[model samples]
Target: MSSSAAGRPDDPVAALAELTEAQRQQAMRRWRLLRPHLEDGVAITRLAAATDASPRTLHRWLTAYRNDGLAGLARRPRADKGRRHFPADLRLLIEGLALREPRASIATVARQAAAVARDQGWPIPSYATVYDIVRRIDPAMATLALDGEKRYRDVFDLVHRRQAERPNQIWQADHTQLDLWVITPAGRPARPWLTVIQDDHSRAIAGYAVNLGAPTALTTALTLRQAIWRKSDPGWHVCGIPEIFHVDHGSDFTSLHLEQVMADLRIRPVFSLPGRPRGRGKVERIFGTVNQMCLSQLPGYAPRGTRDRAGRAQLTLAELDTAIGTFIRTIYNHSPHGETGVPPQQRWESASFIPRMPDSLEQLDLLLLTIAKPRKIHPDGIHFQGLRYLDPILAAYVGDSVVIRYDPRDMAEIRIFHTGHFLCRAICPDLANHTISLKDITAARNARRRDLRAQLRDRASVVDRLIEAHQVPDPMPLPPPAAPAEAPPVRRLKRYREE
Candidate 1:
């Protein structure tokens, strides 16, 4: 028969075009198996013996190839390709068992199905057939049935990902404990927390803070301030007030102080749902990327479960901070984003849109720089957290209830406000020349208090012993004379018992 009439092809490419993808793959596989016999004249029996196929199958394939071309070697679609012969009820039962909570093993499901089939006098399916039925169930349905709604939502639920059209239209903030350990100022190894502010549109990191303490409202505020203000580094240019500040449902993010700052800046705060963190996935991805690309290369890279990770610590917090800043400016911001196909810094600058900024750094600081605490001005100064803050202006406001705002990073100085008006910046004379953090001051105060309490306990025990000594009368001195008289009488007259 001619090639066209026999549905065969003299050209391999033309033959492939006429067949579906599966058919084409099958034809290629068969061609590979028959090549030695057809081209090298190897015996058919030898080829069959070497391969998984038998001689009869080899002969059929060879004959078909000779009659037609490569097309004849392609497997034809079966009439019952997807249709199963089992009863509808049996299929449902198998699926139900497979999808039960605490999902049974495939073998267990097959055994149970076989037992049920035997009891019902229905056609029992082989294990492979049972497995195929279980596999055919929709994965989403199976996940919901076997796992739970939460797992199903996390894995299979369709998400409406949030995206910003402009660079400053949306910003996301989040905190993660870095994988690397760094030495604190006090020479202790600690895993630092990293708070990051990022532009949603460009995926550019605007500002970040590395601190030994857990993320607090002050940390978030400081990071936000850094993000909104222009950077001193010429290479890093991402800054400005965002239209929408997106964050998770963390207490720091939900603080009234943060809310007030957002209101003053005309930025709307968008919080993710209480238990749903998917909304913050964009910012969260940056943490993993940083851990893998930046931190994993650094000294003391303590990924979870590493023993003696602290012993490997070599870099101080400041050094680590500088390293992270360098990485962001030199590498991360410059690298092309996998999703955007453009470097973050380049994308952010491409729009040429001027960001909305505070009128002045002072104005921004007034809102985002410090945590506010209500303090009454004493005769000496303002007392807060066991530290005395002094200012000449405070002399006039003595005994007055005023508000003092201080940077947790520097407890040496604080800004005093009276009835919401800016007052003088007060300083602690005791903490002058050297910077002392709020945490340091607190730790010192606690240590001192503990020491005083220990002394008091010792003194209290001594006083109790003295009081008992003074209150008790001296032991009566009468017993010695009576004992001597009885011994003398017994020696003189042993027989006079009455005397």
Candidate 2:
């Protein structure tokens, strides 16, 4: 019989011509080994060894024999292409979307991609498909499912860890705008700025200041000095220095004068990161509550306007200072914070976190006043910020560098001293004439027009009331005739009527 036909009767030769020369030779060798084993019920392992094959290969051949008798063992028709289990095009789309919108949600991107596919008449994959593709491409993306959740969780964890149980452990300091309005010397509306330092543990406002302008380094130092002095006073019997002093990155907080004061006091000044309000969140939240509960409810309270409106209003710098003082003492310190469930004063007293007081007000002032830029007096006897000042003591140091000190709230009056002697006191100009070039002319003109209109309306109403009451009519007063001037040498004696 031919080689193709000379196979076992049960396993006839089938498709041997289709096999490659190498494969055919291997099959022939396998058949020869198995023929001897088939007669004696040979072991599958021994047969595989004789054929130079694995037990798996012997099992495959046995299964083919039982199914197709022999043809199944013949090499199956070659596959047209390799199997492709991964979805390549879909993965590319998901990765591209992720790159474009780093913060976008996976579901959101998937929906977007689906919409794009539909619009372009392409195959739209399911959300699961997109998710799997993202996971395969970038494992880190899978780990961070949401963006801000982790950060917020971390903040709370940090707060729990850092919260102080004692009052003197931490103090938060910040500046906030107050809504208390005051009438200017010129009768215009004004608001003041306030700086406050509060004990974090007790929620007590340790020190505060309401100033004409935003609190400067000098104002902050002075407020701190006053607080320390009060705490150390024998009458108060309070003594404790804070371990940490936290503040935002305001110019006052970072000024060299403030730094020196802190250093001298042995206080650690900690600054919050720029643009990261969370670092100083406690103070920021306090300001927010003050704005919402106290500031927004005040009469004549207006949102901050541009420089032009503020100038036109002739904002009262001094009166605003006084109003802020009242707000802090009467309102903030006394009022109970909802979270703390106690007034700041009560909390402070309970905690007993006061510091040692200073011996004298002069000593406190000296400790607070730091070295500042020296500005020479102008011809008008003014030093800086349009403040007209005079110092008999400053006269000796006319050309020399002398230290200047004053309350920011009461800019109208400044105390000038040379070498610690009370030299001179200067008064600020009236609000109406405060500016040099009469730039407040517009406000003055507007005020005058408003007054005239009001007066005219009142006069008309009064006349109507008189008519209704049948009162006697008051005749309108006429201007007296002008006195005739002496003739200029009879040169103007022409009479038109006679001509």
Instruction: Report lDDT per candidate.
Output: 0.86, 0.61
**CA shift at 48, candidate 1, in angstroms?**
23
lDDT (Cα, tens digit) per residue for candidate 1, span 1-499: 2233434446856766889988878987997898887667788899998999999999898778776678789887799997878788999999999988788998999999999999999999889998999999999998888788889988898888988998999999999999998988788899999999999999999999998999998889999999999999899999999999999999989988888889999999999888677767889999999999899999999888777688889999999999898999999999999999999999999999888999999889965556577889876578777888876556556679988787777878888889889988888868777544656545655665677799999999999999988895768766565444444543565577686
| lDDT (Cα, tens digit) per residue for candidate 2, span 213-276 | 6678877876676556554323232234567778778888888877776675668987866644
Quote each prediction's TM-score.
0.72, 0.48
Q: What TM-score quantifies how close candidate 2 is to the native fold?
A: 0.48
Q: lDDT of candidate 1 vs native?
A: 0.86
Which regions of candidate 1 deviate over 4 angstroms? 1-22, 25-76, 185-188, 305-308, 367-371, 434-499
